[model samples]
Structures are given as structure tokens and as C-alpha cells.
Target: MTQGASGRDGGNSLKARVKTAKSRTLASTLWLQRQLNDPYVARAKREGYRSRAAYKLIEIDERAHLLKPGQKIVDLGAAPGGWSQVAAAKIGADKPKGEAKGKVFAIDLLEMAPMPGVEFRQMDFLDPAAPQLLREWLGGPADVVLSDMAANATGHKKTDQLRIIGLVELAAEFACEILGPGGAFLAKVLQGGTDTALLARLKRDFAQVKHIKPPASRSGSSELYVLATGFRGRREATGEDGAG
Candidate 1:
């Protein structure tokens, strides 16, 4: 078989999976037998979340309390927007209660239809102009920046890890650019853990940078999220701003 352009040979390859299949249950067979059969998938359907991943945000927020009415937020890599949905619901972005107004700016390379009180932007976040557009939309800095953007990984392991790290770094830098004092940043990272420099940078900027794997996240997945809260709003935190 030819290697994919990204060099990540799809996941687990169909042949390897078939070779291992034997007396698996129907549930296992159908799930990626047709799709991923996670119990959370079933629960998400009943609970009305866009995807099972929504619960991950809920679990993280349960401890952090990042969501609030009237806070401005930016959701990066927000296609099939599960996190944006939760932010909207919690912040009254869905219904707009009196004096309680919030907006979730959802951005992705892929197109999403639309969500009320959520601003959708289909653009490469790497674009130099994207931040300005977002700032204009929010009318200033934001209270939160959430990123779930992982590059389409090639099964090659190290390359994929590096790519994801790069994305995380970009998100962190962007968070620093746009977050107000006491702002928070949430991002996905791998089990090998975040790079030391990245971790160190977060620690210096936020009050605390902690790794959390929410209960709603599948036990089998190696993914974990880094929650960095309480932006110091200092010069060091805004290095990318070039105010030096």
C-alpha cells in the first residue's frame, strides 16, 4: 500500500484490524466495525450534545467553572462544535437572558452550518489576519480561548506528536494574544505529556497550568487536556504582541 501524503497510514489499517477480529461482540463489530462504540456516544445522543466530546468540556468545567454568562470566547478547530455548544448553553448565548450576553466564536477549516449566538469563521487560524478579525468581532480581548485542533495525524507516531505540539503552541500563543486578565485556555495534548518549554511558558503566564483528563473522556484514549487559568495580563504573557 502507498503511504499517504501526510505519511500517517490511516489508523490501524483495515488488514491488521481484520486479522485480529475473531469472537468480538456485536457492539464492538458495529462500532468502527462501522464507528467508535463508546458508551458516551449513546449518552451524548440522549443528552443532546453535538458529540460525545462535549462531556469532556463539561467534566473540565465542573472543576474550573470557566463558563459564565456574558463572557466572550473563541473556539479553535471548532467543527462539529461540541464545546461551543456547551459554552453557548451555559453562558446564555443560546437564549440571551437580560444583561446576560455571551458569544462563542467558532473557527475551523471545514464549514459548519450555523449556531445562534455563535459566530462561525471558516478560515485557517494560522492566517496573520485571523486574530485581528476575532478581536474586531469580540470588540476587544476575550475571556477564554479553547483549542482542540490536532493535525490529521499519520500513524507515524513522532511526526504526529510534533505536529500536534505545534498546534498546541500556536493555540497557546494565540490565547496569550487575546485573553483578558484572569482569562483561561483549554487545549488537548498527548499522553507523552506537553513539551517542557510549552509547559514552562504556560506556568509563567497563567496562575496554574494543569493537565486534566476529564471523566467523560474515554479511558482508553491517551489524550489529555491542559487547562491554564488566570492569565496574569503582564508583558511577559504578551510577548507575541511585540510590545517590547
Candidate 2:
């Protein structure tokens, strides 16, 4: 078959098409085809990124200016290390003997291969002990917190939305606890809209809250990112409230 521009037919070919095998489900075949044809996937492979998801963060940071040199960062659910890779590079974590030297701490339940300038921990962030452990490892409050975690989808839209919200909420709470004043939090959230209560809490705690759908995000997918900046620090109980 003749191919278009994206194929390897003497430099003028079309996207690669995956042929369905007898044992492969149609859904699986389609997914493979999409992956093979995705330009971002090909670019990621060429650029040595761990996953195509890296471009999402790269684009967001380009517009938002969230990552910076010499900033301490924590990346939750950083398996496959795409976001962690971006964070480390942006903050100059790998730079040796430079003023821009920074640190990146990454944690996830899934084991990830070690990357220079990132300290990886294999543990669930939901563990009660996790926050303190991360703090200890970081040596101080983080200038930024990032989370790209999502629960395995059950194929029910509502259930998936709720699970994603719950994960982001937990990550936000953790950010509030460990973030320094003026810190920023970025997390993956469903596009159906964040829960009202969670939105309210975020607004109360942050100076700015925005939902961004980066271009790298699939157009048909519900994935979005919530960027919350300027943490106000934890609220201290007033006397009357404490008395109660």
C-alpha cells in the first residue's frame, strides 16, 4: 500500500497501520495503531523521553513558567519518570557545581529506573507516613509539587472521574502540607470538572487556580491539569475555633 508523509516509503509515506492479529482484540489493535501513528510518541522515542506524557508538562511549563532553576520539587506518582525528567532538567538538578543546582524527589508505587538528578522512592503516596517521609528526604518545604496519578479506569465514566478527583484532592492536601509559601501545585484532573468542594478549598488555599488542557493531551480524552499557584500556607486555628 502507498503511504503518506509520516511513513517510511522512501521518505514519503503515511502513518504506520497496525494489522490486527487473530488473537488481538479489536480495541487493543486500535490502541496499538494509534500509538504507532502518534507523532508525539515518535518524537518521545527520538528524544529519549520515558513517555509521551513528558510533552504535556513541557508545554504547560513553557506557558505557565512553573519550573525554574534552583527550585526544590516533589513529583508524586512519577513512575515512568517523564514528569520527573522534565522537573529535574528544568531545575538544573543534574548540573554539577553550579548555582542552578536543585533537587527533585519522586515517589510512586511502581518501580522506576533511576534517572540522574532524581531521587526515586518506591511507595504509595497515600500511605500515612508518606508526607513526612517526603519532607525528610527533601530537607525543606518544596517550591513545587507535581502529581500525574490516576487510578486504573473501571470503564465507567463517573467512577473514573471520582477516582481521579480523589487522587488529585489527596495530592493537593499533601502539597498544602509540604509546600513553602508561594509554592505551586500541578496535577492531572478530569475535564468533567473538579469537585466543587475541592475547587473551593483550592481557591481558598491558593492565590490562583486554573484548569489547563495542554495540547499534548488527547483531544478526545477527559484529561486536564489543574495548576494552583501561590500557596497561602496552612491556616492556623483561631482562638474561638480552637476552643470548640
Candidate 3:
């Protein structure tokens, strides 16, 4: 792939985009620096993935084999559709009729460019009506529910963590409501002795619960992924939004 100035291809993979010197603030400069030098960012563009976040899903899938031919998947907070793209491909979402026809249903607040094998809904996952709409579209339970959903960062540390935790909790509730028996759920989490309670709940719900820090995640980052598998079907009388 011929990488351009924006680093959209594999050619010159490690080269950084040169930026003009300006009177920008220190934080802005640092952010620009990080973006310019991020190899994963460049590689993601080259591979035509929506974002570098795609590789995190790839790493975990390599470990868990959650995406199978003809499997149905729900991509929570799949803005820009990177994870959705990966899941869609893994599940054989695109093919000639009756040829391993898998499905990927992705929901997010941000508009995303189209990707093959992905059916997208541009709406906030937090909307009260969102889950209903998703269910109507899915027509039944799904094989996997994956969440890369994150609350918009407010910069304050504790608040940001809490906000993301809330999103993760909501995703879990959605998973319990809709994931098929023996299904899987995955979420991005910040590591720091946080999310222990959430982890405990996940352990109770699934046969296996483990955490992974994928190589595609930035080294300076505190993010890790939680993988929960073998979902025990929810009992009757459980609410549509279960234990959010």
C-alpha cells in the first residue's frame, strides 16, 4: 500500500507526518506528535480498516475464536465501524447467497463510512429506544455482543473512568438481554484496579472471564479488554435491559 502524507498505506510505515511549527498549546502539540508517530494508526489506514482499534479485536479473536462462519454479532458503540468491519469479515457476513451468510449489526452515535458485511445504525446506544430498534432489526438473539463504546472523555480521570464504566455496564445489560446461550461479550476497559465489581459480575454471568491487553493498544495507554464467554441464558421475568 502506498502510504500518503496522512499515513493511509503500508509504504513508509514508520514515517511521521511533518507538521508546521505553530503557537499551539503543549497538550495539542503532544497529541499531534502522538498521532503522527503512531504506527498502528498508519497501518490501520493502509489496511482500509476504520481505525487502529481494529487490531484489538483481531488479537482477541485470535485468542477466543468467537467469530465463526454464519455467526451473528452485535457491535456496540461501533462508530467508524472498525471493530464491526473485523467482526463482519470474521463471521463471513459477505458472500454469494447462502454462502456462509453471517450478519453484523453495528450501532453508534457517529456516522460511519460503509463497509461490506456490516449493517449500521447511526444512533446513540444509550437511547432508550435503541435496544428495541436493534432487536427489531436482528429478529432474534445474537452470537456475540461486542462493545467499544466509550463516553466522551471529560479529561478528569475519575469522572472519565466512571463514565466509561457506565457504558460498559449498559453494554453488559444489553448482552444479557440479547446474546444467545453460549454467546460472547467483549468490552474495552481502563486498567487501574477499577472495574473489579464489573469484572466480578461478568464472571458470574459467563463460564469464562479474562482480561487482555492487545498489542495494537498504545503502550502509554491504560486500556484493556474484557472477554466474557458461554453466556447463561437469562431467566424469564428478567427485564429487557437486564442489570444495567
TM-score of each: 0.81, 0.89, 0.85
Predicted structure 3, TM vs. truth = 0.85
lDDT of 1 by residue, 1-244 (tens): 1233112344433432322357775545644532233456656666677777888898888888889888999999998988899988878888844544888899999998787678899998888888888889999889999997777767677777788888899999888878888889999988784889899889878888889998876566678899999887856655653232
- 159 in model 3: Cα distance from truth in Å? 2.1
TM-score, structure 2 vs. true: 0.89
Model 2 residue 109 lDDT score: 86
Instruction: Estimate every model's Cα lDDT from 0 to 1.
Output: 0.79, 0.85, 0.79
Top model by TM-score, which number? 2
- Per residue, candidate 3 scores C-alpha lDDT tens digits across 68-89 of 9888889988888889989988
Any idea what lDDT model 2 has? 0.85
Model 1 clash pairs are 8-154, 8-155, 31-35, 32-35
Ranking by TM-score: 2, 3, 1
Candidate 2 C-alpha lDDT tens digits along 1-244: 1232233534544767888899998888988988887767777777789988898999999899999998999999998999999999999997665554889999888899999899999997778888788778888889999998888888899999999898889999889878887899999999885999889888888889999998888888899999999888766532322111
Instruction: State the local distance difference test value for candidate 3.
Output: 0.79
